[model samples]
Target: MLNPSHLHRLFLYGSILLSQVLPLAAQAETPEEIACYNDVQGKVAWNQKGTRTWGEDNARNLCKGVVQRAKRISCFEAGILSHNNWSKAISDCAQTGGEAITAIVPGKQCIYNRGGYALTVQWYNPGLIVFNGGDADDYSKYSTPGTPFRTEKIALGQTSCTDAANRAAVVRIIGQGFLNEGITIAVGTSVGIGTGVLGAIACVGTAGVGCPAAVAGVSVATAGAISAVGLALPEVKEIAYIGVPGSTNYLDFSGTAWNVGISNKVPLSQTRNFAKESAQTVASSIKDFVTGGTPGPRSITFNNQAGYVAEMVVIYQIYKDFGNGTIIPIPVTKSSGQISLGFSKHIDIPVEIANLPISVFINGVGTTKNQILGATVPANFSGNRCFKSFGTIFNPQSSNCN
Candidate 1:
């Protein structure tokens, strides 16, 4: 309908408007501004110095790049960031300092960290799976059944290996996940298995599994069978370490064998050496406790028959919850429509009159808004001096006679 020259001018004007609007729209969708999106919505975040968000299609493409080539990968390939950001936020956690990042994808680090061990289980789908330290406390066990393979980053700590600081960092990253499964956590050892929930905290063992704090020399498996229904929180925050409180001459080796009698008589130096060995065990438990993870070194006991009584020093830390100033009020109902109070309203009236003769009573009590304040009374009851006594009976300004 217009001349060619006019049409060209209109196209230029439209282009200018689009160029200005597009960037503004993009800015509004920054990572911080983006709301939680669903699986279908396909939103992903990358926290490198700061948060970077991408929509579904773009997020998927970027996730694939990072998972395969990027220095770090977010937990959600295309989902709500709030729902899953533990691992993604710290996948390259080691690079971010000593802090370890927990990934929902169990043993993901182990898979990449332990290149020698072949990965057998496929974690492409979501479910419960053991990430590391399958049936034993050895990283090598990752190559064995019941153990999910992991690379260097995912491998559990090596016993007696001294990397206290790094181990502490990594332990913190996985503490919550391990505790939910009732799996013992330590720098050298970690276990993850299907627990029926994404962030389940307690563990339910298979039937017939049992563990003795100290198994007599015998080659058999032992585990405490706990239910998975609601095992989600570790009851205690930390465990105190008492130096291997057990008999010096009595020794149990992984329920596999026990050497008793004449062989038990080790020189005093060897006895001290054994306690030194336990120091690492104690260290591991302490790390778990300080990091809010389950205690390592499950149990220790002594044989009464043996004349060995060792006094291992114990170390324990108390648990406490410092208030953060968040208060919830309690609400309460009353028997009578009108609540009443009983007190000597007159300052002139002896305080003893109200304190002895009448007692203040409240009927219904419940929280209103994190605070509790409620009372009820019968309409037929006589009004107390505090309510009815006027100027002659009491003066609010008077000081207590007592």
Candidate 2:
């Protein structure tokens, strides 16, 4: 038999154990464990800056999202951008009245060698066809505008053209140059450079086809849409929108989109896509509002002490976490567009306390978590949010990182 006091003690001890175990047990299934980890400490690539001094090699990956095959070709055509002498090559080809190469499809041919000291090859076999097949006269099949040739002769010419087109496609896709558009062909269509009908060329005993640029005139209106409210969660920022077109994700406190924390959350399919959409949104938005939105020569500065990477990311993150109200009424801004709050110089934590919630006390004095203003956060770090003194409607602890 147990005394009343003993029974009370047993109940109290059991209650304590149950309380701790229950929370942990319940927490096991909660979405909270799929956490987002952030801590600043990575280096920003120097070429990632917008300055021309970064040069070609460095600029390749930096301007990847902003610069495309067509844009690269246009840059070369304009003469300000230079890479692999391709622009010059295209210009030279253009001057000769050769058409600009367009899209390339891959196909193969069997080169038949005629017996004797002389060499002859035949086309018509299974192989990859390349886009951007060059001039129409370049192919051997048709002699003139109305003339049709024998199968053996046509095969030989196609074999030759296939080789040239294939090589060109490799160079175009891999090289830092502009991609050509496509032209109509009797069989269907073929790609070409600059502009004109595609003629297969004979070089290296094979014929090749030209391919068209996959992305042409991709506009803001065409991209898919995303919900802004669902993306407010920190953990979801990493995985949700990085790859989907028109998806939303917060710019980290550090300005760069390709951060460790950001990348870890991105799925394999969306890595390049998320970066592309983000760049387009920011660039297009700025262009709409600012006269010369290029903002040439933007520099990225890292913080040595805390390992913050660049200024743009920090400012962007600030806007993502807290600047929606600042630019709402502005004429040029889109409803989905984000606002920019000028960079801060303070390292005090950034908190979202709209209705003034409870205060956090360290030792009896109130203080917040550390956050740097302006730029220089590490790639891994998320924006600094103070301890969430719990209580309030919809103000969960996850909103503010301790």
Worst 10 residues of 2 by lDDT: 32-41
Residue by residue across 1-402, what tens digits does model 1's lDDT show?
899999999999999999998885565331211212232132334433234544454443332212111112222332224534534443422232111122232321111111111111122111111122234222121111111112122221111111111111112122222222332223322232211123211122232233111221121112421112211112121111101101222111110001100111322123232223322322222211111122222211111110011111111122234569643322221111221111111111112111122222211222122111222222223422111100100110111112
Candidate 2 residues 135-208, lDDT tens each?
Answer: 42222111110001112221100112232222221111111111122211122212222112122311112112
- Let me know the TM-score candidate 1 reaches against the reference structure: 0.19
TM-score of 2: 0.14
Tell me how candidate 2 scores on lDDT: 0.22
> Where is model 1 poorest over a 10-residue stretch in terms of lDDT?
253-262
